[model samples]
Target chain A: MSISEAVVMNGGNGPYSYEQNSSYQKGVAAAAMDMIKEALPTTLDLYHLPLSSPNPIIRIADFGCSTGLTPIQAIETIVQCLLDLIKPIKEPRFRTLEFQAIFSDLPTNDFNTLFTNHLPVRRCYYAMAAPGSFHGRLLPTASLHFAYSSCALHWLSRVPQEILDKSSRAWNGERIYYVNSPAGVVGAYSAQFGRDMEMFLSARAEEMVSEGLIFMVVPGEPDLVHDSQTTLGSELELLGSCLVDMANEGIISKAKVESFNLPIYFPSEKELKQVISRNEFFHIERIQTLSHLKMHVAFPTPESRSLCLRVALEGLLCHHFGNELIIDDLFHRYSLKVAKSLFFLKPESHESISFSV
Target chain B: MSISEAVVMNGGNGPYSYEQNSSYQKGVAAAAMDMIKEALPTTLDLYHLPLSSPNPIIRIADFGCSTGLTPIQAIETIVQCLLDLIKPIKEPRFRTLEFQAIFSDLPTNDFNTLFTNHLPVRRCYYAMAAPGSFHGRLLPTASLHFAYSSCALHWLSRVPQEILDKSSRAWNGERIYYVNSPAGVVGAYSAQFGRDMEMFLSARAEEMVSEGLIFMVVPGEPDLVHDSQTTLGSELELLGSCLVDMANEGIISKAKVESFNLPIYFPSEKELKQVISRNEFFHIERIQTLSHLKMHVAFPTPESRSLCLRVALEGLLCHHFGNELIIDDLFHRYSLKVAKSLFFLKPESHESISFSV
Candidate 1:
């Protein structure tokens, strides 16, 4: 299945929902506000668009805004920046500029909860949601003004095809992610990440105005760090071990474990730069390491850490396994394993990168 | 609470979902196709709008699409008509006309299901959805090209305030609709319908361009038929009697029944005409009754008829009573009563009217 068909954050206003368990994401958005403001242009080029309505509108879309509490903060910041930019404009139409906030995610995403959580803001902006994968064209050509996404680019459009092929050398046999997989598996994951990002950027380039600014927050390691040394790597390793342990004990079929893998790939700063260089339409304005993110403070203990990951991964896991109880048990085991592992040491944690294009 | 908060069709693709139980609405759309084509302008006035884009987009919005299997058919028909209208134009910009189909409903509606069911069509048009009550402005002014709504106008913006007020003479005590209520109660519902329609039209006027057309399908009776004599009136009466029986058996509170009304009003043709005449921006191009609808063929038995009503009203009942079992029991009792009553005669059922404005 395509990642858009199967992956989403846990929905509803419950204990395990992304709405409740996104403190780390919320922290990232809050910390990234100053950078977002600094990167935005002083004057918005709204008049150049082909739109001829007397009342001009600036449409901003937030990609991967699951249940939308954290992403709303980022969206609000961007909207505020644009408002400040146009405050003293001499043109009457520019002074009366309207905005439309479009929250986009997979079609299966929990948009009802997103809209309900952000009801009052509907009066301020023409708030609506577009349902589709970000890796494809979702809006009209040159229809968008600003684009923002937070901590969502780590997801590949789909798992690499070779990793699932039984005959391929790149087939990931035991590992669920590319953390400690074979070198071929790592290559396949890296190649897929490049292709997915290219598709994503190409779609955004078509949908956005020429003068549009896109700020993306993603999880990546520094150039000096190895994939296995990052905190994200350790977490995936612990999760994979838990599944393998369950399979060895004959709880779930080992064949099932071998066939399944998460469709997430956290790139390093070097890898991100390489991918951006290949795309011709956009230039990197700035790529700053977010020093303000306190991952340890956001997720202090193993229990809280497990919850954050659980909310993010539950939909993907449940869709692959077709069992919610198995996911719950796996997360419980992974949390216990985290307590014993060196995960809390947070060795060179790598989930802080904000780049403007 | 507003109608948008409490009202939704049964969600999920289950036996009780609106997706499964909307055969009558589907047939009405299919039957109304001929009239829809005839009334549509032979040439679409797309160039008049102030869009200056190298590529132009024609946006169509379908309001009150519950779970969306039926409204999609109407949307596809309308898009096809516009495509035919623009096929002969020699202008290069007119040759590649793009469309954006926006599906609108209440915030609580199951938009995930709506998007998923129509996934393939997303490639044909940049299809998306907006969440809000259609009685208010949901799109930008002069942004929409074609507006279509089917079988959703009868739902008032909310239950009439006077009908719920204890101090008022119009307080509909123990009656769930205005079928045979007191004169004051009927007047309250009629007034609410008028105000809701006016607001709905005003919003559409602001959202549409000067040459834009809106086609709406609503349920109403002819001028000669009394409100109590119609099949819709008999159906509401049966549902109310079922609730009263449960109340007498100490199953639920009478006050609960008294405080509840359907927020649904089936206007007469004369009433619809009066409301349309009050709105200044729109002129009646054509108002045709859908004679091709085969209500008897669509739902031949009482069990099927009960199911159709259950799928439409279950969410509203569950929201008000705070229990799913009560709604099931109420509908079951109502079904048995329908089998024993004069419902099979079909007694001039009034639920088909299509008008272009």
Candidate 2:
């Protein structure tokens, strides 16, 4: 599908949107703040050039900044870390330092809300928004010092070509995702993720100053499982079941169900590390998956989980089906499914990766 | 009056606003564009350090950028000029140059329109908004390349203190402006302008790279004029007369009329240059007043003039008077006054000045 026709979050303050149900995102962002603080000094130390001889402005870009307050929290974290690092630099020339933070997302993202509602409250750095996809170059050559993305890289630039071709060995027949697909289908999905990640890293490498760093937080699958037991994985399974049941009842066409494939992927830790190794634009400083349960005892309830999930996926689903699609009914059934399967659901692990460019 | 209490332009796309009556401003901006294009190459050459040895990003700032399309045109002019200059520089390292344009205005300036409506269509440079008064530091130390302000500097940071002091010799009795006022009132206005301009230059000096340039387009009176002969000056006189007539008919309180004073001033060319020399932050390169008559043969009509004046001053007026004030009636009267006085109206020359830090 063309990018313009693809799903985006419900814009502004719409109900059941990423903008409205953003508590989960805020929690994830808060957890990532410590990791960002830990990584900043080491990242700045690796730069060969001094800070303020020619340019006192340090540049950073946040990829996949959908309409929410999370980008504001993320920016404050990065800006504060930079301030702490710059405070001790005894060089007189480095005394006057400033920061430039650039926020990037798809063209359809509600950047107006980000600028009007979120940016006015921010004070640490000069704020900018660059509207584009992160899988390609969004800034000038070697202009970035640090690049960040939180819970956004799971999206593929486009649906894998192999899945769309019914003749291919990797054809995902009558399924919307790779959860229970054939070996060939799984391989195609993995290959696509690798390609997209490679492009993402390569573009950043070209845009970053030498020794710059990138920090990303992505939804990760639990190890030793082909089918996901994590809440996110299970939720998708539930959503898929709803569609299947609709198809079974003739409420939706079976052919339509078969043709639909979500442009989302959740890689295991091993798959993520392998992609990094394949694309040598960055040296992996650290990579770890933190359990949400271990960090916060009160895991997101089914209702909250469904709201968050709907906010993230509703735009895409609406685009694929129709704007008039019965999203509320779909989510209502998915919420019930989630509640019924609550005890069996495993809390998802968030993958945090830090690397030097 | 406190800045927080003073009226700003009617924000967004209101009936009569900066966004609505911006053609004259645009025409003035186009004239200033030539002055900017002429100054940039010479200013860049004067910098001891090259454009992108340590910092590859060139920065320009536009002060008083409320919600309007004029800023976009202004930025495009500056960016296009820089690109032209950078094209001939064969140095391999300088080939990858980028531009960061910062737009600044008051906290209440309609930046939402700037970001949402105007910025998205712009692709040449990275866009940023710095929210603050220009009379104070709005950027990091030595961080700007070029600073431009057109039709904005006349606004004082706050109403002159003497105007508010009823017992002072400069107390402006039953007048909203200094024109045709007592000698003390003119001195008070001139003193306030001098102070504000000094602060503006001093802050720019600290924020600009050595030999960085500043191009300002401000309203100016012809030589040997204490009271302004400009259209802006005459309109204010007309508006003041309307208020006076209302006061005479007991339609409004006489004390309310006496308490009002506009926080705006249009300086003469000699006065402008004198203040720049006094501050000693910038060396004057070229300062000239261009006749509006020579530039545009058909001066703005009374109807057009009233609309333009209302857009610029209505917010401030509404704040001082009650929001219920019949602004239409006031402008209608003012428009008639303008039409009757048209034959004696002297077209004001806009002052254009370029200086190097």
Candidate 3:
């Protein structure tokens, strides 16, 4: 297939709606924001610029900004950190700073919520909506000072239609997680990741100032590529099993779903570093695995756990699988299996944390 | 442009003839073989099988096994490792072992050398050469036990012509190397690395057995991605500067040269792991940055360094500037620069090394 065809097939238009309205996505964004909050002091230190300094206006952009909350949360954290950092420097130091924030998403994304419900009231932030894929050119050269993206890089533009076509077995008739998935399907997904990451870093390198800092928070496994027992892998297996059971029951005809594939790819920390290191604009400031944080929110209670799974299903599975399957039956099976699976309920021994300056 | 067009444009008989034909490739093959030798004892320890075990035939393949000694060295290493491991074991253990090694390269590569030079010696070792791009599928399901590739994987099948077309200044007459170059030309190389690595690991996962091992040696930087002081980065800058100089002198017409780009990519160890970990079949038993090793071989001496630059000029520059400039001013200037620049002659800190399984 040509890259153009591949782009059209894998572009983030379909199934992405899951992330658009997903409560789990919101939680993930919030957790990501918390990490951004912790890193902001360091980010400011590395950039060596006062957030409140009015000497020069600083502009920030979030590519693949999704619903814009990810960036909103990130900006909020940055502001809080700036406030904390400037508190000791006196009010005079704070009065000299000027900041501007830009939130970007696909032209097709709903921007009403961002403009109406989310923009911070007190902060001096301006919103400009960009309506194109970040995988290509998104911003002008050296136009951004700080950029942030969370929980959205993994979704390819769209699942390849070849994989989604009924004649193809590459899809295997379900929206399973990545592990134990077909090789071609995996290749397609990985290729999309490779392209997306390349587009991301290249664009950022050109758009960011020499010392600009880019902060990214996305779902990941530390070494899941090598070890299938990792949380991401197990989650994929669980999803696959659920899909397989549905296929076995005749609830969903195999032919209708044979080639259907999801556009998700959760990279490990090593993978993320590889992507970061290749661009050479961003340096590793820190990396933290927030899976523990995710686990905390995901498994707080049985009701919460159910809500989390429901969010996951609605955001990830339902987005891909649609409401065609027996929701109750599929949900019951998925919930029981996920509850028993340590990957879903247990907090990993390590927290996912990472920083790049 | 479609992938088919990209493949056709990037895919050719093969580029890099000097290294392809030089003892350097032989050395790379030997070094890879040495890694296999050292790891063989452990590999046997894990498998508890003898070199001659017939119960499960030891099937091995090398992805991107370019027309060099990688496969020959790997086969030799594996055979020697297995034989040495079993020499002290019981006869029953030895009697049950059988081994098969497959060497794969692009359909355009010269496989005759692999068959005639390497595979003839061992009666017990079965050898077969397959023609296809390793980045695409080339093996049967669960058909390989051990896979090894070195240096070659870094080279995408061909440089993406879209970036090279004169209309696109992406190459700026330097060709795809800057686009694909690990350093200096553009950081987009990282994304390319990620994509190539993803294809590599995903393809291998399906080809490898349950307990398969893959040992790969690739060029990489240990520091964060943004550091441009690395040897690879310097080399790219040198090349880019040289091209810019050529353009300034009007030795090469800007429009003709700007229409094409270089296609080359080198990855860091972190990037390699990210690629490998994406697939569950292989675990990273060990990873080492062999920048020192590559540096040692890449610049064996001041004369060798000059020769390397000359080759680059001839292979890459001559096409744009024409033979007249290459023979007259380009060679002399490049040679003089090489002689004057103490840094090129200095023992490089970043020598290429092997990352073993």
Candidate 4:
């Protein structure tokens, strides 16, 4: 979708409604726990901070923290794990060090819901909100101890310029996403993710203390014969077909479908390594792709699994076509398309990566 | 002055023009350096924070940081003194620890001037702004390391309700301040200060770690024979007479002058000690009164000295009268009155006090 019209998870009720359909985020948050634990020991060992230092307060920032209790829930897991790791240490001074947990997101995020109604009364850390974009500097230099973001890195800062220009070679015609699109369209999305990632890393390098750990859960192409050969690719292809079919049926205009493109990309392992190695600020610790079918094993039906994708994409669809677009009809048809694709296509994959700087 | 109508020094120019007439605040900031140093040794000793601790960043908060470069200047001094104190400890881990300087004031305070256009780069510590009032909780509980406030504690969160009530015995009639007012009116202001101090100490107790050093510079009565015997008291008395004479001349309504009272108080030495001792959270560290004339050696001219008072009080007067009131006329009359009083009146005493909790 256009930058100004970029729909974020349905601000109102819909399948893509973050409030009603965030089980996917909850699952992603659960999977991120192990990665956080693996990164903590090295973070604690390498950070040469003293207990009696001027600001003996630990700062943990959760960027792209969406509305709901999940953000706090995720922080509690990290804080509790760190506490356990520190409890065994014999330093009495460490007990007095305070934790300042800063939860940040876009200015439009529901901070009132996050801080006023949902924040727990007896949190181990001091809770505060820094409302801003993560693509730029949010805190002061060398301020953060640990940074964590879940299911958020895939979204680009904005629609790539080449894709939006009608005369540009990268114009994404007849498709709403990069996956399964032409090479030119795919290259444009990849380029935007690379630029956004560079900005993100630079801002983070200035903010993090030496050897601070960063954990990000990203949707990526699984290791296979071809990078785009995955079930998620088929799912997006079917969803695109549904939109085109709607346009043909005169339910929506063809130009409307062409104007809308999801500001997201699923980077392959090679692409991720190229960007990470290019920026010497961070040393890659680990990169692993988790299977979508295995991750969604708790859901016994295809519709349940498809709900996760629909909840996230509905906002962009509704914003571009019209807010009056029937969300239930859209998702119901989309779910059937996904179920049909699954009959012949394989399950897709999502990846998680860690860094230390 | 009504809260909404308070025309704080011409934000662009005039006495309260923090940009032009902050010599008085600068003097107070300089005088505060010694107290901060004294409190630092104890604060560093009792805090028990380790340099290599999890969150080794020291947090120093400057409450009531009005618009100007003085706040930065004052914080640089504190951060430098602190760095010097910590340098001799010989802990390698201390090298990585950073300081976070938080500048806080009322929401309307010129934070834009303090942060965006004025903040210095390549400093020793991280800088940020916390926009809120200090009377209630501002920072997270147990989050602060060292707290300092100068020439600001005199402002009460709200004017005393008793003085505002026309039918109450404590109603301050024909007076714009408590200095030399009727005993009941003076007692109302005193009572308000006591209550506010209690709330202030309690909130700080919850927000500060055990044994955090809090340095406060309060303007109060010296060890004199009479309450109004101080120079500051006489200055206020002279300013009050100017307003009364103006009301008599129909320059301003008599009722207008009677309805306005500054939400400020210069407590006596006895009153200062009583409040600290009453609250168990803090121990009185030091209390001393310095002569305003001696403090303002840089300001040799009577008008220069009067400008300090006029800059701070003009907003209140404009809020009480109309914003359209001629500031030059008001301050000219007030300056002449101050010059006349200085001919015979002893220089006023302004006290400074520090606390450790």
Top candidate on DockQ is 1
Tell me the spans in candidate 3 whose CA falls farther than 4 Å from its real position. A1-357, B1-21, B43-55, B68-70, B87-96, B116-123, B157-187, B224-229, B290-298, B301-303, B306-333, B348-354
CA lDDT, every prediction? Answer: 0.78, 0.72, 0.55, 0.67
Q: Which one is best on TM-score?
A: 1
Higher-DockQ candidate among 2 and 3? Answer: 2
Give the CAPRI rating of model 2.
incorrect
Which residue pairs of candidate 1 clash?
A50-B52
The sequence of per-residue lDDT tens digits that candidate 1 reaches over residues B1-357 is 455577778888899988888888887777666667877754346556544357688889988987757767777888888788777778788766688888888888888777777556345678777888898999987888888887889888889889888889987788888877777888888899999999999999998877888888887766676654554666887888888888888888888888878888878878898898999988777676766555556777778878988988887887776652387788888878877776456534534444333
Q: Report the lDDT tens digits of candidate 4 across residue range B96-170.
A: 667877776654455444543456645767665554557777676566777888777778776787887889988
Residue-wise C-alpha lDDT for candidate 2, range A1-357, written one tens digit per residue: 354325556667777767777765666677688777776676567336434454466887888878678887788788878777777778665565678788777656776566656665437676666656688777766768888888788888877878878899888877788777777877887788889899999999988888688898876665565633333455566788888877788767777777778888788777788888887778778787643333122335667767777887887777776643477878888878877774325433422222212
Worst 10 residues of 1 chain A by lDDT: A347-356
State interface RMSD in Å for all models.
1.4, 3.9, 27.2, 6.5
Considering summed lDDT, which 10 consecutive residues are worst modelled in model 2 chain B?
A: B348-357
How well does candidate 2 score on lDDT at residue B211? 66
All-Cα superposition RMSD per candidate: 2.6, 5.6, 23.6, 11.7
Q: What is the lDDT of residue B191 in candidate 1?
A: 92
lDDT of 3 by residue, A55-100 (tens): 3346677655544345577676765665567667744545545455
Q: Per-residue lDDT of A1-357 in model 4, one digit per residue for the tens?
A: 244224344433344457566765676676677656665676566236523354356778888887677788888888887787777767655756677777776544544345434566556776655545688877766768788887777788877778766788877788777666567777787888898889889999988888677777776665452544444455676777888887788777888888877777667777887877788688787766533224345333668756766766765666667754566766777777766664323433422222212
Indicate whether candidate 1 or candidate 3 has the larger DockQ.
1
